[model samples]
Target: MVRNRELLSSGNAAFAGLASSFSELSETLDRLASVADDRTAARAAGLKARLEEFSAKITFVGQVKAGKSALTNILAATPGLLPSDVNPWTSVVTTVAINTKAPADVEGPTNTKARFTFFSRDEWDNLVVGGGRLGELAERSGAQEELADIQRQVQAMRDATKARLGRHFELLLGQNHSYGYVDPELVERYVCLGDDVTPGEGNPQTGRFADITKSAELFLDIPEYDVSLTLCDTPGVNDTFMMREQITLRSLRGSELCVVVLSAHQALSTVDMALMRIISNLENRQIILFVNRVDELQDPAGQIDEIRSGILATLKKFNIASDVGIVFGSAKWGEAALMGSYDGLSADSRKALEQFGAMHPELAGRDEWETAWNLSGLPGLLNAVAERVSEGAGKRLLERVRRNARNLTNEARATLMARRSGGAAVTVDFAGHSASSVMQQLAAKYESDVAEVCQQLRDDLMQRMQSAESGFVKRATDSLLEHLERHGESGTWQYDPTGLRVLQRAAYLSFARAMSAKLSKLYEDAARHVEAIYSAVLSEAEGEFRIEAPHAPRVPAPVGLGKTIALDLQSTWWRRWWQKRRGYEAFAKDYAHLIRAEANSITRDLEENQVASVLENARAILREFLKEHQETIRRITQPDADTAEDARKALGVLQAGTDTGAAFGEILRGLDDMAA
Candidate 1:
């Protein structure tokens, strides 16, 4: 075993450096808290808590048989941990938490390392009765035969599951299983789709429980990486049942980075266009396209450039941004390099490795295994991920921590100066009742304003969505007519839904931009109102104390809006629907109505689910901000006896020629240096 030759050393070093800085920042805050006032100490503690709780979440997504699990295993440095040959019917979403604690909701012993959650009763009923999203789509398209087919499949799955688990199936719903240890057999029992043994039988390692499993979470302590990482392996997008597609989309919404694995032989097929649409919906996520199984190519060294070019061209043709990093490699090569099993490689793979080495002469002088590792492209991929982490979440966290620290230190200095002065204690005459009343009025006004804004935005978005739907119906109807004239509708006519997807994307983007701008302005206005109130009340005080306004909270963009509609599905039901509708004029007219109804459902989902949620969260955040600042005002205007005594003690310590002021100044300077 090559223990020291870890492929993730570079990325691990980057994360370790950032973790060290975070630790230092936390320690500095602790030191400041010991000698600071109550409010400053609380602020420092909050900053430290945020530092400790930060983690980067990355999700791996791709179609079925795209080598996602294989690539995930190689990246996490735990080869063979996940089964690479998952069946298409498997719907489990596996998450690997590296150097991070299990989620708070997970209940288990301290030694528990794996948790498998089953679907709730409601969720199972939805899949069975509602037929998931595919049934909805089929009904909207008036494809009765297709809808029945979907329901039949669902019923068959339910019956098979009941037979396998007997009466324990219902008992397992809404429950989770935890294990103190994990192995391949343990993982396969919950994640794989094989059905050799029954669940209620004496065989405990059967995959019969896999169908009802919702998620699998594995916690591992990998010492190579110093920071926390959550790697989620979502089910493939091309499942026949389409349940995994919904699961995958939900996973994407929670992730900050996405690694899209593609089979090198069929890099980007038409079926993968849904994946493209999903990627396009990610607002500020970092995406890397990894073309796996390149070792299967006859001449990887000679074919890599052409493959890269073709993939880039496809992206450009689709109007996607060109900055998405693309890397070509084979996970098998990485596994071999990790285990130092060069002798086990086939002759052709060995020859290809040699050729890869010759292509990059810089590695000729290094060990052959090292060269093979580089040829795997895992090193490059890791470096790219590290770079993104450093520039994205890591940078933002460091900035926020430094800003809060400086502000707290400045406030502490102001408090000290006020205490040291021999002047009478400054006090504002604003009563607590009056402050509460004023805040209530402001909160009511904010609520009213937000409601009005959301209503208007909703109306505008609905109009746009309707228009897009009408245009798509017209175009699709015309296409259907053309197909009828050409082939008399005897055979199936399959039309691309890319146009509808594009229009829907435009509407979604418009909604995102408008909501973001309006809500951000509202947040700023609310902050200013509170600040103005503070300024007015504090002006009545007699001292020259300086109090900075609270920092404005960042408004999050509307989420859960990237839902993949049924129209984007490339299932056979679409063609079957067309074939069932043989007449031309009636087919076009009925199809148009069905499409219009689907559009209505889509619009309603956006308004009620996505838009409504955003507005509610925004209001809650605004309310919290106002409430905190109100408390702050009350604390400053009416300091308790304990706080006054603490201030006096701090002032006396300062009077004894303590270097507290100089220390604060040094901390400020350090913050400035970090900002630079």
Candidate 2:
């Protein structure tokens, strides 16, 4: 624990230093903007906004009852802020926005500290009427009984919701509820399942809105850290209804880091194949596996290695990366430590902490509470998160900010020198040079090429989806036939979806890699063109000034591809369908048709939701990149006369021995250091 803290302390200090540097840099930009031209001032303002808005989004994902909420609360340093006993079926994606500005999507009064967004009417209608993906699965599998059951359940839920909220239930859809302040009770009102309370009969404040709530965003102030952090507690993957699974996937869209929580006793159990599939699909993300509830183990010191080994083997078996960081801890220990209550600890927990402490000489003499906290492994996990942020998003943001700062500062210096040198007589011919036209041509070509690639990939994926679906149906049919032959259709036959999952994963990976690579190349080409134009413009200036090339935009990997399909569900639909089967030939044909129908939905989802979305995002990025660079070219080529005059006046004031030049030089040095 001492070692973990040391590492965590170091990581925190390093991240704090980086944030301080950004703050200092932003301040310098503010000062510079006061005496700079319009273009420079605008650039400075933009940089400031980017710096202020930067946040490292991290999500916690795991199977149901995996202690995700408890771990999230511990990490956020707000124990019990989120309901640890949240129902597994709750679809809300709770975000703890710490040390950050409220998200733009959050709407309400300025003082609103918590926001609960309800599902849109369309979304709700789809879920209720369509029975979500599960209904589609049931319908395709000919499981009339299951389909009716799901519809009944959804109807009951809706009726209960309407009873609780009355007419306001209809009004609340597609709207949000906001609060001036947030507390556990208020949160439970919207997020808890309140299974203890009979429908429409309990305290209205308890889980009254959980059924309709789509997401919850809580603003929190934690001054211990400097950088903005958004910790997302996603719905569990192993949800019974699979509604939360889709919600979880959407929650993971923009998250750069994921913490997969696992129970020590059932780490990577067969029931958690959904969790494993999620891990396998997050190929480009930083993953941390936290084996929670280690205190439940009889020999914490002796069992940890074995558990870790088993987890690694499972990951390998699923073709997931084995290099993910694994930490063993108990959220109970974290809670106990945070409350400074040692007496609250169970005998088993206390004994586990003692054994953990004994294994590490540095922890031998530490306070029992502190030792327990260390044994909780929160510090180590926190340190890992901090390290990833520093090396990944933090580093990338700093580099881009520094580059832009350097270019803007250098441009300001060059403009001042040119004015002083009386370069007004120089007639640099920019006639017939249309950066806009050239960029448009380039952008059009890039878009066309990207479209071609997307179409090709989409077609290929469609083919693969069909092939995989056919293969799955054939295998399932054969398995059923064997079962029928052996037991004469009297017993149940479980059809594994592992083969389908593998095929889907491969298709997703192929699409992601291809799109990522193509987008990166296109962006690089666009950036290069912009750089060349900027260089040409600079070459025509009075003095020698070198501008740094614009950094390539960070293209987010494809999302929605990792989503859980209807086929992934484990149910008795197969047996139920088989019970009404005819002869082997007729049974096989009907089964194939039904399974194919279900598989076709997966194809449509991938194409419409995943593939189309990726293409649209890529195009938007390309267009935005080109648009910004075109503006940059215009700024360089066509300077505003009034702004130039204002800059001259500001420069004259600085030239009057105000030491502002020295300040500017210091800012440049800071940027250089940051870049280094």
Question: What lDDT tens digits, residue by residue, belong to model 1 across residues 1-676?
Answer: 4343455565776566677778878888988887787777887899898888777778888988798888777666777788888877789999988777766554677677899999999999988886888777777776677778888999998998898799999999999999888877889889986645555764565577898999999988776776777889998887766787788777775566888889888887777876876776564347888898888888888888888888888887776677887889988888788777875478887778777778898887887667788898888777767767777777778776776676577556545554554322445445545654576678789878877877787788778888998898888889878988988867665556667656766887787678778877887787668656555544334232322332333322223334455555556766766666656877787777766676667667666656666667666666655666665554444456765786677777777888776677677667667767
**Off by more than 4 A, model 2:** 1-35, 104-107, 198-204, 406-496, 539-570, 583-588, 594-600, 639-641, 644-647, 650-676
**RMSD list, candidates in order:** 4.0, 4.5
Candidate 2, residues 1-676, lDDT tens digits: the string is 1122222232376576667777877887897787666667888899888989888998898876789998877666667788887776577889998877664544576766799999999999988997887777777777788888988998988898899899899999999988878888999989887676666786758888999999999988766666778999987776656787787777666787889899999998887876666667665337888899998999888999999889989888876677777888999887777677756578978887777778888877777667777778987887778778887887788787777787677666555543443333212343564654565676687778767766876787677777888888888889878877887746655666667766766776666666667666766776666556555555445333445544444534334545555455555766567678777787767866766676666667667755776677667666765666565554444445654574567567667966545555666777777667
Superposed Cα deviation of residue 221, candidate 2 (Å)? 0.7
lDDT of 2 at 433: 44
lDDT of 1 at 230: 83
Clashing pairs in 2: none
Candidates in order, TM-scores: namely 0.87, 0.85
Cα miss at 650, model 1 (Å)?
3.5
lDDT of 1: 0.73
